[model samples]
Target: MKGTGEEVVSLFYIGTAIMLFLAFGLLFIVVTYQRHFFRMKRKEAENMLKVSLESEKNERARIAADLHDGVSGDLSAIKNYLSVLAKKESENKEIFDEIREGVDAALQNTRAVSHNLMPPLLETEGLVPALKGYLESIGAKAQIYFEVTANGAVALPASVAYQLFRVLQELTTNMVKYGNVSKCDINIALNKEALTIDITDDGTPFNFRENLAKPNASGLKNINSRLHAVGGVIVQEEEKQVGNHFTITLKNVNNA
Candidate 1:
């Protein structure tokens, strides 16, 4: 009877150990499956964003083409005919000049919008030069100075380049309108594992966490979505008290 009791006790201990091991193994598998499911969802979302961005680019290109080729051509023809009319009538010079000036202004606005819709520089020259051209265009409106610096540059994919350009555009626009800064600085660097970009404005301190929660922060949200689509991230950089600083990081990118 004593031997039987001992055997029963040993069997109970073995059964308890096996149950605990099974519980732990099941928990691990569940955790791993959840993580994998979340990752797949995130990848799907990013792919959706990529498709949306491509569609947006195509639409922009079509509209820009219409404005530049269709509208601008008609405006030029009108301007030429107006010039001829002004030449014919010497007494109505003032009236014609006013009309001509109006037409010229309209033409200028059209060209600007067309260029903004899809800048030729961006397609032909790449991101940096395209940004330089954009800065020069905006220089007349805002009393801002532009500085672009780089360290051992590597060519970025066109999609990445466009997204980065949009990010810079939004930053500069916000700085000009709200931050009240005069000078802008952009730094670009590339290494074996990452592409790092810093954009600093000498205006106000920026808080990414704060703005990210605001409902009206469409610009920042746009920036975030763009970065995420390209496997990059935008975070507010600290260690600078003078102005607003932001950093963009792209990881596991092949830099050549």
Candidate 2:
């Protein structure tokens, strides 16, 4: 009877162990499946974001081309005609000169708008030169100084460069408009494993994360989206006694 009891106890223990193992195996499979499903969804969302940004860029480029090639050309022709009229008709010289001045101003504005939409330097010279040219172009008008420096250099994909430039542009615009900025510094560093950009400003400090949560933070949201599409991240450093600092990082990118 005792032997029978021992055998029953052994059988019961073995059954429990097998049940526990089967339960754990089933749980692991379920968890793995859930993880994979979430990963796929995240990937799909990123792909959609990239597609949307690319479409926006293409549209901007088209509009810029139209403004430069079509509108600018027509305005130039008109200006030239006005110049000839001003010289030929001495009686209406003042009026022609006034009209010519207006046309010249319009031409300048059109070119500025088209350039802002899609900078030719960006397409031709690359990111650094584009940024420098942008800063120089805006320096006199914005009443703010900008300095750009690089520790290491690598040729970035055009898409990445465009998005990064847009991000910086948005931030600089915000600083100029709201931060009462005086001087801004932009530093770029690249290594085999990562690329980092540090932007600092001597301006009124603002809370980036807090502002990002506000309803009227579209510019900040756009910056976030652009970085996400490029697998980069922007982090605002903790505020000190003065100034604002932001860091952008991209990891595991192929420098080659």
Q: What digit string (tens of lDDT, one per residue) describes model 2 on residues 3-50? A: 999999999999999999999999999999999999999999999999
Q: TM-score for every candidate vs. truth?
A: 0.89, 0.88
Relative to the true structure, how large is the alpha-carbon lDDT of every model? 0.85, 0.90
Q: Compose the digit string of candidate 1's lDDT tens values, residues 145-231.
A: 878787754567777788788888888888888887888898888777788988887887768778888999999899888888778
User: Candidate 2 at residue 197, lDDT?
Assistant: 94
Off by over 4 Å in 2: 1-27, 152-154
Tell me the alpha-carbon RMSD of every candidate. 2.4, 2.4
